[model samples]
Target: MKKLLCIVLCLALASSLLFACASPAATETTDAAATEATASEAAATEEPAATADEPVTITILRPGDEEKVKSFLEPAVQQFEAENPNITVEIMYESWAGWIQTYPTYFEADTQPDVIFWWDNKLYDSSAHDHLVNLSNYLSEDFFSQIPQGIWDLVDTGDMDGVYYVPNSVDTFVMYYNKDVFTAAGLDPNTPPTTWDELLTDVQTIYDVTGTPGIGIPAITGSEVLEEFVGLFLNQATDASVLDSSSMPLFNTADGLSALTMVQNLSKYAQTSPTEYGRGELRALLRDGQVGIIFDGPWAVPTFKAAYGDDLDNSPIGIATVPLAANGKKIDWAGTNGWIATRESTAAASAKLIEFLMSPEILLSHHIIYGSAPLYASEFDNAAFQYDYWKVFYDEAQNYKLYGMIGRNSATPAAYYTALEEVWQQLVLGQISAEDAQAAAAAAAEGVTARNN
Candidate 1:
């Protein structure tokens, strides 16, 4: 009876041990199922696909007409967006009217765009502030190497200072002439007048043969007036010495009087009284072949091209460097406008956009459409930018000079420009002598400096 009881006890103990071992396996299986269910729920809700709720957008503020933006900028933006699926570009246009008043307000409000198109005017002054990004640290050395060292020097304020802007286009003056008119005048259309004296002779010949005026220069008091006397003729005479080293007006001198006298002499061959012609009228007269020559900027190429078609390059119309001085020295007055990224922007992304826009292919296309000289050095070598009309003025970019105010400490040029304009109109109308014009210009500049002080 004792042996039977012991065997039952042993069997019970073995069963208990087996059940304890099995309990851990069952718990582990249940935990595995729970973890799988939790993972399934997480997969179902895993943050909804990137939608309108979250978008990465870059904004650019530029100044231009809608037609221009649609024609040139929109396509480029579209390509950028297409390539960068996670990013979008929004372009906002500032109106041409009152833009100067409106642009600075954005910075004041701390609402400037990620990228902006700005001129050298007052930008160098602005660079002293913290409003602009320090591009020296952000841009790679290879990128800066692509642009001319002179241009980099043009924008650089100092050795430690940053490059606040990247130039997109450069502009300079050139004389456009009707080759057909030159040919009719018994002058070789292929050989343009190389000196001021030669230009005068050619003008007389064109007048004698064609019975039309030799040249059309704006004599009206406005921006064109200021540009002709102060922008072009003044610089040509003084070798871009419009201002003294001390940043004082230097145009009230013998050189300045000489420049004015030259302008006066040229006026005798004008198609109409300088007062009677505006830039538009002159361009129209030139287009209709009513005038032999007109001094204008590079921006007018498309207008001339449209009027003359293949003849623009073939022969009917041609571009020439402004006639040289007797000493064989020539200087071109130029202005540069460029893209600036604000300190408030995403500098990395804004820089990328500039890099993309300034690429050889993109810049070439933009310059082709805009009719301005390309900002990059290599772009000059590109055949697309080498149309005959372009080459005539394009090479001059190498030897070009910027406006007086391009320097860091130069005074406000526009302040005196109005007075200069009034003086120019008087001179062109024979109301004021060259010496008188210089005196008046000096007084005007003095008044501006006094007011600032």
Candidate 2:
């Protein structure tokens, strides 16, 4: 998630609860609410109800190292399994912290997963690069083509060698702020900033008048955080790649330097750079009114809604597309989540299942259940997608440039981002000239490239 925005389109399950007859998952204790999947032993003991012809065991694996898999996802699987007797899903959860080691060992073994969970763009690339089965074999062209044009764009990521992935739901980055804080600072809550310049000015104003941070800037999400939006800004101004693997040191262009300088300079106005604190901590600052703005994905909407309520509409919340670079249109850096066949898959069967998953009705249910945006027009039939809060993402989706998790561990990606962070810190700390920091960062990047290469 730190490598790119993972919050947009992630999910599972359907509930049959109708009207007042429903027993929400919340009826359980807090621990059970966290993750209620029955263990293999527990399942054996219960003789649980299942679909007519459930598989002996339908294994599902996902890597997040996040607690949400158990808390939020397990219940969905349980409910689905209850209705589908032949398809009892056995979820194997693992965290991202040790995933680099655990994943290969688990997936490569005889027990490969039938369905998997992943952060859309990053996981797709890693799986594709590793020669995971091409997902195209699992779904039809008509089906893929029919996915809302914008959501489908996420899977392409402009690589085009092959359609290695398909994003099932839609998602993007937006500026989330506390309207009450804005009001206290005498800024207009109804008008969130649209340009990078306005954002800067707003931050300084908030800090000056309210003694609260103007914003929370995160370098931890990696360069893609700024690179995706800024790439559009600068390239529209003058053509450039954030990192050019075509050359030795990746991206060290004048434009690249300028992007870093601009972002780093803003650190002086930010409450804290994200690398110094976990992302949840930063969001908490926004909720508690310590910070006025944070660049986050659609997931923050529900979180703030639950935590603040009327505060969200009155004193508390607002969501808008990420601020635009002067020359670029407002855009989001979105990712995808979908099914992929394994190395020895049966193409026909895989294709059928993929088709089932892509159905519009299923897509709508999935997104609604997870608080995600749907990737197909079929979902818009549900009243939820019509909201203004959701429209911001829909608008951003049209202009988004989906990002892969390439920079997480790779030299070009890491160095380029690290350079941006160090440059920002230096400029904020008044330790080096902007030009000097860019040059030095580029030099250091060259060394990282040579060594990694």
Candidate 3:
């Protein structure tokens, strides 16, 4: 009996050991299955990354000389593509003249490039405002903070609530003169005009002595050239903007009359058929020594450099701050152009590309190649910006009371050109008095308020 009881005890101990070991194996198998199921569910829900089979192609426009633009842009595009294998970027090159004429048509067709190098003041001029993406939606606060607050304020026209443009070029006007012309006029080449009276005297002296046109006046209608040319003097005389924020004429005062009168006086010595020239033509005239003086932006630097070589300040081309008006504060007209993304579908990719372009190295390179003043404070240290002529521009940008274009903040940004084009042409042609021009400008402003507001 004792032997049989011992045998039963042994059998029970063996069964207990087997059940403990089997229980652990079953628990581990169940846990493994649960983990696999969870991973599979997560894979089903998560968004997929872009792949070779599903590539995204985006187009961006770089408006300039085709060969010059392609020289820098093509390599940059290749680098961007290599970094982002799934994205293919196409660059559309258009000359400045051609782009200006065709940009409106681009919006009409809904076939605008995904991203465009755009004019800041003209943001709301056409259907472009509707198509532009509010970059604030996609870019982070850190990204927006990269630019100065002043620049942000300048670009924020209050047309809409969000940022629509990323300014890459913040340009102000400067007086460009030909030293050869000045020397021939019996004037010191280094002593350019500093006041409206002095400018008038210099113009008369140059024309009298050298027989060259004292200046090239860009009075071409249907373009912003005439508007900018007159507006700069208006800014100098009034020390204020020509149009109020509401697009009302602010230049109908006595000071405004004087400014227009000065413009008319200066027109007498300008190249014949002043209406035939635009800013670009004026630059060419300056280059060829046909005109003694003209107001232009830093964009003329590269061309002048090519014509005059590396030392532009010492070359025949001379740059100075825009001449001031009597009793006028140091003021000048400023404008900006930047990148704008138009397509909502390509916003992400466009933003990525913009961020890449705005990187310090790339942006500096762009400023150098495009002959723009350094947009960032950090860029001032670059060797490319170290030229003497750049200081005049940089000073104007930093120290001057800069006003933007007329109607820049209004719904009808192009009102300045539309309303004043004919009268301005008449004023420049000496067919109308300055008082008449002022009255016509005021009426045009009124028309803009009525039509747009």
- lDDT per residue for candidate 3 within 1-453, as digits (tens), equals 999999999999999999999998999999999999999999989655333335789899989889878876888888889988878899998998999778889998988898888887777776677898877767767778887666676675565878788988789999999999999889999889998999999999999998999988988868887888899988888877787767788889999999999999999999999888888888889999999999989877877888888788678999999988898578888888889998776777787788778777778888888888887778878877777888888788877878776666665677667778877889999999999999988897788788876
The list of candidate 3 runs beyond 4 A from truth reads 1-56, 85-87, 94-110, 380-383, 409-412
How high a TM-score does candidate 1 get? Answer: 0.78
lDDT of 1 by residue, 1-453 (tens): 899999999999999999999999999999999999999999887633333224566788767776876677788888877766666788887665656667657777877777877765555344224577766666778888887765654553433366778887777678888887888889898898888789888888898788888988786655634445345677777775565533467777677677878777776677766777777778878887899998877777777777766346775777888887555666766666788877533666677678778777788888877777666656668765656667666666656554433233333545555666787777767788878878887787667666756
* TM-score of every model versus the real structure: 0.78, 0.70, 0.80
Candidate 3 C-alpha error for residue 31, in Å: 41
Q: Can you list the residue pairs that collide in candidate 3?
A: none
Q: After superposition, how far is residue 64 of candidate 1 from its true place, in Å?
A: 1.1
lDDT per prediction? Answer: 0.70, 0.58, 0.84
Candidate 2 versus truth, CA RMSD in Å, comes to 22.4
The positional error of residue 143 in candidate 1, measured at the CA in angstroms, is: 1.9
lDDT of 1 at 338: 80
Q: What TM-score does candidate 2 reach?
A: 0.70
lDDT of 2 by residue, 93-158 (tens): 777566645655656564556555544434323333353445564456788678666555445434
